[model samples]
Target: MTRIFSALVIGLIFGAGIALSGMANPAKVLNFFDVAGSWDPSLAFVMGGALVVTAIGYTFVLKRKAPVFDRLFHLPTRRDIDRPLLAGSAVFGIGWGITGFCPGGAIPALGLGYSDAWVFVGSMVAGIALARLARHTMAARAAGKAV
Candidate 1:
Protein backbone atom coordinates (compact mmCIF):
# COMPACT_ATOMS: atom_id res chain seq x y z
CA MET A 1 0.00 0.00 0.00
CA THR A 2 0.95 3.63 -0.43
CA ARG A 3 0.89 4.36 3.30
CA ILE A 4 3.21 1.46 4.14
CA PHE A 5 5.69 2.42 1.44
CA SER A 6 5.60 6.06 2.54
CA ALA A 7 6.21 5.07 6.14
CA LEU A 8 9.15 2.87 5.16
CA VAL A 9 10.68 5.66 3.11
CA ILE A 10 10.23 8.14 5.96
CA GLY A 11 11.79 5.73 8.45
CA LEU A 12 14.76 5.09 6.19
CA ILE A 13 15.29 8.81 5.72
CA PHE A 14 15.12 9.39 9.47
CA GLY A 15 17.52 6.51 10.19
CA ALA A 16 19.95 7.76 7.54
CA GLY A 17 19.80 11.26 8.99
CA ILE A 18 20.54 9.96 12.47
CA ALA A 19 23.51 7.96 11.16
CA LEU A 20 24.82 10.86 9.08
CA SER A 21 24.54 13.29 12.01
CA GLY A 22 26.64 10.99 14.20
CA MET A 23 23.74 10.77 16.64
CA ALA A 24 23.78 6.96 16.52
CA ASN A 25 27.15 6.94 18.27
CA PRO A 26 26.90 6.48 22.01
CA ALA A 27 30.38 7.98 22.53
CA LYS A 28 29.26 11.21 20.93
CA VAL A 29 26.27 11.39 23.25
CA LEU A 30 28.36 10.40 26.24
CA ASN A 31 30.90 13.08 25.33
CA PHE A 32 28.14 15.67 25.22
CA PHE A 33 27.03 14.63 28.70
CA ASP A 34 30.58 14.84 30.02
CA VAL A 35 31.31 18.37 31.17
CA ALA A 36 34.56 17.76 33.03
CA GLY A 37 37.10 16.22 30.67
CA SER A 38 37.35 16.08 26.85
CA TRP A 39 33.70 17.05 26.51
CA ASP A 40 32.44 17.27 22.94
CA PRO A 41 29.86 19.90 22.05
CA SER A 42 29.17 18.60 18.53
CA LEU A 43 25.77 17.24 19.59
CA ALA A 44 24.67 20.78 20.38
CA PHE A 45 24.95 21.65 16.71
CA VAL A 46 22.82 18.60 15.83
CA MET A 47 20.22 19.67 18.37
CA GLY A 48 20.18 23.18 16.95
CA GLY A 49 19.74 21.88 13.42
CA ALA A 50 16.91 19.59 14.52
CA LEU A 51 15.19 22.43 16.36
CA VAL A 52 15.30 24.66 13.29
CA VAL A 53 14.03 21.92 11.00
CA THR A 54 11.22 20.94 13.39
CA ALA A 55 10.14 24.56 13.82
CA ILE A 56 9.96 25.05 10.07
CA GLY A 57 8.10 21.77 9.56
CA TYR A 58 5.60 22.63 12.29
CA THR A 59 5.03 26.04 10.74
CA PHE A 60 4.41 24.50 7.33
CA VAL A 61 2.04 21.89 8.83
CA LEU A 62 0.08 24.62 10.57
CA LYS A 63 -0.30 26.51 7.30
CA ARG A 64 -1.90 23.51 5.62
CA LYS A 65 -5.66 22.94 5.94
CA ALA A 66 -5.05 19.22 6.44
CA PRO A 67 -2.06 16.92 6.55
CA VAL A 68 -1.02 15.20 3.32
CA PHE A 69 -1.87 11.66 4.44
CA ASP A 70 -3.98 12.17 7.54
CA ARG A 71 -7.49 13.54 7.65
CA LEU A 72 -6.41 16.12 10.22
CA PHE A 73 -3.28 17.10 12.12
CA HIS A 74 -3.73 16.00 15.68
CA LEU A 75 -1.88 18.34 18.01
CA PRO A 76 -1.84 18.14 21.77
CA THR A 77 -4.03 20.78 23.46
CA ARG A 78 -2.66 20.40 26.96
CA ARG A 79 -0.45 23.31 28.04
CA ASP A 80 -0.37 22.88 31.80
CA ILE A 81 2.81 21.58 33.49
CA ASP A 82 1.57 19.11 36.03
CA ARG A 83 3.25 16.87 38.61
CA PRO A 84 3.53 13.80 36.38
CA LEU A 85 5.11 15.89 33.61
CA LEU A 86 7.74 17.33 35.96
CA ALA A 87 8.55 13.97 37.53
CA GLY A 88 8.75 12.19 34.18
CA SER A 89 11.03 14.87 32.76
CA ALA A 90 13.36 14.60 35.74
CA VAL A 91 13.48 10.80 35.39
CA PHE A 92 14.15 11.04 31.66
CA GLY A 93 16.97 13.53 32.19
CA ILE A 94 18.59 11.33 34.83
CA GLY A 95 18.31 8.28 32.61
CA TRP A 96 19.82 10.14 29.65
CA GLY A 97 22.72 11.33 31.77
CA ILE A 98 23.32 7.85 33.10
CA THR A 99 22.77 5.87 29.90
CA GLY A 100 23.66 8.44 27.23
CA PHE A 101 20.92 7.32 24.88
CA CYS A 102 17.41 8.62 24.25
CA PRO A 103 14.82 6.40 22.53
CA GLY A 104 15.26 7.97 19.09
CA GLY A 105 19.02 7.49 19.01
CA ALA A 106 18.87 4.13 20.75
CA ILE A 107 17.27 2.26 17.82
CA PRO A 108 20.04 3.11 15.35
CA ALA A 109 22.69 2.58 17.98
CA LEU A 110 21.27 -0.91 18.50
CA GLY A 111 21.52 -1.54 14.76
CA LEU A 112 25.27 -0.92 15.02
CA GLY A 113 25.35 -3.95 17.44
CA TYR A 114 26.40 -2.17 20.60
CA SER A 115 25.81 -4.09 23.84
CA ASP A 116 25.27 -0.88 25.80
CA ALA A 117 22.58 0.18 23.34
CA TRP A 118 20.70 -3.08 24.00
CA VAL A 119 20.96 -2.56 27.72
CA PHE A 120 19.74 1.03 27.46
CA VAL A 121 16.82 0.05 25.23
CA GLY A 122 15.86 -2.81 27.52
CA SER A 123 15.94 -0.58 30.58
CA MET A 124 13.98 2.11 28.80
CA VAL A 125 11.25 -0.35 27.87
CA ALA A 126 11.12 -1.68 31.40
CA GLY A 127 10.82 1.83 32.75
CA ILE A 128 7.97 2.58 30.37
CA ALA A 129 6.12 -0.56 31.44
CA LEU A 130 6.63 0.26 35.10
CA ALA A 131 5.35 3.80 34.57
CA ARG A 132 2.23 2.55 32.85
CA LEU A 133 1.55 0.08 35.64
CA ALA A 134 1.99 2.81 38.25
CA ARG A 135 -0.36 5.10 36.35
CA HIS A 136 -3.04 2.42 36.21
CA THR A 137 -2.66 1.67 39.91
CA MET A 138 -2.90 5.35 40.76
CA ALA A 139 -5.97 5.77 38.61
CA ALA A 140 -7.64 2.79 40.29
CA ARG A 141 -6.83 4.13 43.76
CA ALA A 142 -8.17 7.57 42.87
CA ALA A 143 -11.36 6.02 41.51
CA GLY A 144 -11.86 4.28 44.87
CA LYS A 145 -11.43 7.68 46.64
CA ALA A 146 -8.34 6.33 48.43
CA VAL A 147 -5.83 8.67 46.66
Candidate 2:
Protein backbone atom coordinates (compact mmCIF):
# COMPACT_ATOMS: atom_id res chain seq x y z
CA MET A 1 0.00 0.00 0.00
CA THR A 2 1.02 3.58 -0.59
CA ARG A 3 0.69 4.46 3.08
CA ILE A 4 2.92 1.64 4.27
CA PHE A 5 5.53 2.35 1.59
CA SER A 6 5.53 6.02 2.38
CA ALA A 7 6.06 5.32 6.06
CA LEU A 8 8.92 2.95 5.27
CA VAL A 9 10.61 5.50 3.06
CA ILE A 10 10.17 8.25 5.63
CA GLY A 11 11.55 6.08 8.41
CA LEU A 12 14.58 5.15 6.34
CA ILE A 13 15.27 8.79 5.58
CA PHE A 14 14.95 9.73 9.24
CA GLY A 15 17.27 6.92 10.28
CA ALA A 16 19.82 8.01 7.69
CA GLY A 17 19.62 11.57 8.93
CA ILE A 18 20.14 10.52 12.52
CA ALA A 19 23.13 8.43 11.55
CA LEU A 20 24.67 11.07 9.32
CA SER A 21 24.22 13.74 11.98
CA GLY A 22 26.15 11.58 14.51
CA MET A 23 23.05 11.59 16.73
CA ALA A 24 22.98 7.80 16.73
CA ASN A 25 26.29 7.58 18.57
CA PRO A 26 25.83 7.37 22.33
CA ALA A 27 29.30 8.75 23.01
CA LYS A 28 28.62 11.80 20.86
CA VAL A 29 25.32 12.50 22.53
CA LEU A 30 26.78 11.95 25.98
CA ASN A 31 29.60 14.32 25.18
CA PHE A 32 27.06 16.92 24.21
CA PHE A 33 25.75 16.73 27.76
CA ASP A 34 29.26 16.91 29.20
CA VAL A 35 30.05 20.56 29.99
CA ALA A 36 33.34 20.49 31.84
CA GLY A 37 34.89 17.66 29.89
CA SER A 38 34.89 16.80 26.18
CA TRP A 39 31.84 18.81 25.38
CA ASP A 40 30.42 18.91 21.86
CA PRO A 41 28.28 21.68 20.40
CA SER A 42 27.64 20.02 17.05
CA LEU A 43 24.60 18.18 18.31
CA ALA A 44 23.13 21.43 19.49
CA PHE A 45 23.57 22.86 16.03
CA VAL A 46 22.01 19.72 14.56
CA MET A 47 19.02 20.10 16.86
CA GLY A 48 18.69 23.77 16.01
CA GLY A 49 18.78 22.97 12.33
CA ALA A 50 16.12 20.31 12.83
CA LEU A 51 13.97 22.77 14.75
CA VAL A 52 14.19 25.31 11.96
CA VAL A 53 13.34 22.71 9.33
CA THR A 54 10.44 21.43 11.37
CA ALA A 55 9.08 24.93 11.89
CA ILE A 56 9.25 25.66 8.18
CA GLY A 57 7.82 22.27 7.26
CA TYR A 58 4.96 22.63 9.70
CA THR A 59 4.11 26.02 8.27
CA PHE A 60 3.69 24.51 4.82
CA VAL A 61 2.31 21.11 5.80
CA LEU A 62 -0.39 22.42 8.13
CA LYS A 63 -1.84 24.53 5.37
CA ARG A 64 -2.75 21.42 3.44
CA LYS A 65 -6.25 20.06 3.91
CA ALA A 66 -4.99 16.60 4.86
CA PRO A 67 -1.92 14.40 4.77
CA VAL A 68 -1.16 12.49 1.61
CA PHE A 69 -1.67 9.15 3.32
CA ASP A 70 -4.52 10.01 5.65
CA ARG A 71 -7.79 11.90 5.40
CA LEU A 72 -7.04 13.70 8.69
CA PHE A 73 -3.83 14.86 10.34
CA HIS A 74 -3.13 12.85 13.47
CA LEU A 75 -1.87 15.42 15.97
CA PRO A 76 -1.85 15.32 19.72
CA THR A 77 -5.04 16.81 21.17
CA ARG A 78 -3.92 17.15 24.80
CA ARG A 79 -2.49 20.46 26.04
CA ASP A 80 -2.73 20.07 29.78
CA ILE A 81 0.41 19.23 31.76
CA ASP A 82 -0.82 16.48 34.07
CA ARG A 83 0.89 14.25 36.62
CA PRO A 84 1.47 11.43 34.18
CA LEU A 85 2.93 13.81 31.64
CA LEU A 86 5.34 15.19 34.17
CA ALA A 87 6.30 11.73 35.36
CA GLY A 88 6.86 10.52 31.83
CA SER A 89 8.93 13.57 30.97
CA ALA A 90 11.12 13.00 34.01
CA VAL A 91 11.59 9.37 33.10
CA PHE A 92 12.51 10.20 29.54
CA GLY A 93 14.97 12.89 30.56
CA ILE A 94 16.66 10.66 33.12
CA GLY A 95 16.98 7.84 30.63
CA TRP A 96 18.39 10.14 27.97
CA GLY A 97 20.87 11.77 30.32
CA ILE A 98 22.12 8.43 31.57
CA THR A 99 22.16 6.43 28.34
CA GLY A 100 22.36 9.18 25.72
CA PHE A 101 19.79 7.47 23.61
CA CYS A 102 16.44 8.99 22.84
CA PRO A 103 13.95 6.60 21.22
CA GLY A 104 14.44 8.12 17.78
CA GLY A 105 18.23 7.89 17.83
CA ALA A 106 18.31 4.49 19.53
CA ILE A 107 16.36 2.80 16.77
CA PRO A 108 18.79 4.00 14.13
CA ALA A 109 21.80 3.20 16.31
CA LEU A 110 20.74 -0.43 16.23
CA GLY A 111 22.14 -0.65 12.72
CA LEU A 112 25.56 0.44 13.96
CA GLY A 113 25.90 -2.72 16.09
CA TYR A 114 26.43 -0.82 19.33
CA SER A 115 25.96 -2.69 22.60
CA ASP A 116 24.54 0.41 24.23
CA ALA A 117 21.93 0.60 21.53
CA TRP A 118 20.82 -2.95 22.29
CA VAL A 119 20.56 -2.25 25.99
CA PHE A 120 18.76 1.03 25.51
CA VAL A 121 16.31 -0.40 23.00
CA GLY A 122 15.61 -3.40 25.24
CA SER A 123 15.01 -1.19 28.24
CA MET A 124 12.82 1.13 26.20
CA VAL A 125 10.66 -1.80 25.07
CA ALA A 126 10.40 -3.13 28.61
CA GLY A 127 9.45 0.28 29.91
CA ILE A 128 6.74 0.66 27.30
CA ALA A 129 5.35 -2.80 28.10
CA LEU A 130 5.37 -2.09 31.80
CA ALA A 131 3.61 1.21 31.29
CA ARG A 132 0.87 -0.44 29.26
CA LEU A 133 0.42 -3.19 31.84
CA ALA A 134 0.26 -0.71 34.65
CA ARG A 135 -2.32 1.35 32.80
CA HIS A 136 -4.47 -1.68 32.21
CA THR A 137 -4.24 -2.79 35.85
CA MET A 138 -5.06 0.67 37.10
CA ALA A 139 -8.06 0.90 34.80
CA ALA A 140 -9.35 -2.43 36.03
CA ARG A 141 -8.91 -1.40 39.64
CA ALA A 142 -10.78 1.87 39.03
CA ALA A 143 -13.67 -0.20 37.63
CA GLY A 144 -13.76 -2.32 40.81
CA LYS A 145 -12.57 -5.43 38.95
CA ALA A 146 -9.62 -7.75 39.42
CA VAL A 147 -6.83 -7.27 36.91
Against the unseen true structure, what C-alpha lDDT does each candidate score?
A: 0.87, 0.94
Residue-level lDDT tens digits of model 1 in 69-123: 8899899999999999999999988888777788888888888777898989998
Model 2 lDDT tens row, 36-144: 9999999999999999999999999999999887899999999999999999999999999899999999999999888889988999999999999999999999999
The collision pairs in model 2 are none
Index of the highest-lDDT prediction: 2
Model 2 earns a TM-score of 0.95
User: What is candidate 1's CA lDDT for residue 14?
Assistant: 82
**Top candidate (TM-score):** 2
| C-alpha lDDT of residue 76 in model 1 | 94
TM-scores of the candidates in the order shown: 0.92, 0.95
The residue pairs in collision within model 1 are none
Worst 10 residues of 1 by lDDT: 138-147
Give the range of the ten consecutive residues with the poorest summed lDDT in model 2. 112-121
